[model samples]
Target: MATAAQKPLTGAKVFLMLVAFFGLVIGVNVTMMKLAIATLPGTEVDSAYSASLAYEKEIMAAREQAARKWQVEARIQRQGDGGAVVQLEARDANGRPMTGLTFKGTLERPIDKRADLPVELSEVGIGIYRGSASAVAPGQWDLVIEADARGQRMFQSRNRVILN
Candidate 1:
């Protein structure tokens, strides 16, 4: 009976195997890295150092805002045209309508900063502000409401909302 001769393992073959293994590992790592970078949502603050430096100021502002006891209600409704409408009502602790303020609303996607939509609201009636954002995708969003009076921020609030 005759048997077929088997090929012997050589240094060159071992080197090729090692190179192929490492190549595959490197390829997968690069692809994963690309995906991660593409999907990465940048930091909330532009500069963490700067934000930290102003943390005390932010806290003070928040305290002042709380002291004012402003009642700011915000609603985001999805329109049939794939857009969204923002309605806001502001009042003081005494139930007086908050007027003479500039209202701004932002619809921010919880996961992607790039999907943030800014709405410039105008007072449709005293204390009632209305605005709209075009082409808003339906999903979970953070509604950031801010009211400014005399060129200074008077009230700020963030609320989570779901849109169908």
Candidate 2:
């Protein structure tokens, strides 16, 4: 007896398979996108163009600052409690300790907006300044140190620190 002719796969079946595969891929992509948006902090800058516009002026100011040749060294260490301390030493190009300068500092958590801490350093000695913050969580943090000598000498530096 002769068997009936069998029908091969049709175009509709192939098209449906392609659609399902792509639909799965698209579904996964959307899920990941949602999770990223929900967990991560958004917006590094409110106005990039404005910042770029000031780039030239900032460069000039930096050059003016560099001409003074002030050296600033910064350090961060953990305290006995759940806090951290920052120390800074400033010197002129002549390697003499800097004195009688106004200093400011800040500690910022990169991911948490509310974890910002203002630093107030007291001069322990000439060119030596130190400050402490309480209730600092154990993680990586950003530090900005600034020192100004009247209206003349200006110095600013940024560094990253970790607390345990």
Candidate 3:
């Protein structure tokens, strides 16, 4: 059988291929970065320098907190109406139910800051506290809690719960 000779590759074809490949790569990278930045809510502190300035104080406070040996346990539950409630219990290191502490929490979607829900908890019985939030769409939620005694911070805890 006789066959026609194949044509040599042209510079324009190679350049076009390179352009398409690089264009796809760059496009995908840009899209991913945008999605990451948009979804990852950032910065626990507004000013990093200010936080660093107080770093020692924070460290000391953490040390003191640890020395106190207070323990806090938190739980999130789904209510029948589709809303959610947070239940918390506090105890001393020796395992006694702690009392006379004030509690506050926030219900937030990790990816969306606009859905943040602030909850003020009330002590129901002894060291047990209960707080509720309005119905939230089913997804992963972050619960940040702080417990205070007198006018000082006693303990802090975070929990992630999936409602669904």
User: Which regions of candidate 3 are displaced past 4 Å?
Assistant: 1-44
Using lDDT, rank the candidates from best to worst: 1, 3, 2
Give the distance in Å from residue 138's predicted Cα in candidate 1 to where it truly belongs. Answer: 1.9
Ranking by TM-score: 1, 3, 2
Candidate 1 residues 64-148, lDDT tens each?
A: 9999998888877889999889998888999998888998889999899999999989999998999999988878999998888
TM-scores of the candidates are: 0.93, 0.69, 0.69
Overall lDDT per candidate, in order of appearance: 0.91, 0.84, 0.87
Scanning candidate 2 in windows of ten residues, the lowest lDDT window is 148-157
Q: List the residue pairs that clash in candidate 2.
A: none
Better of 1 and 2 by TM-score: 1
Task: Tell me the lDDT of candidate 1.
Answer: 0.91
Worst 10 residues of 1 by lDDT: 70-79
Of candidate 3, the 10-residue stretch with the lowest lDDT total is 37-46
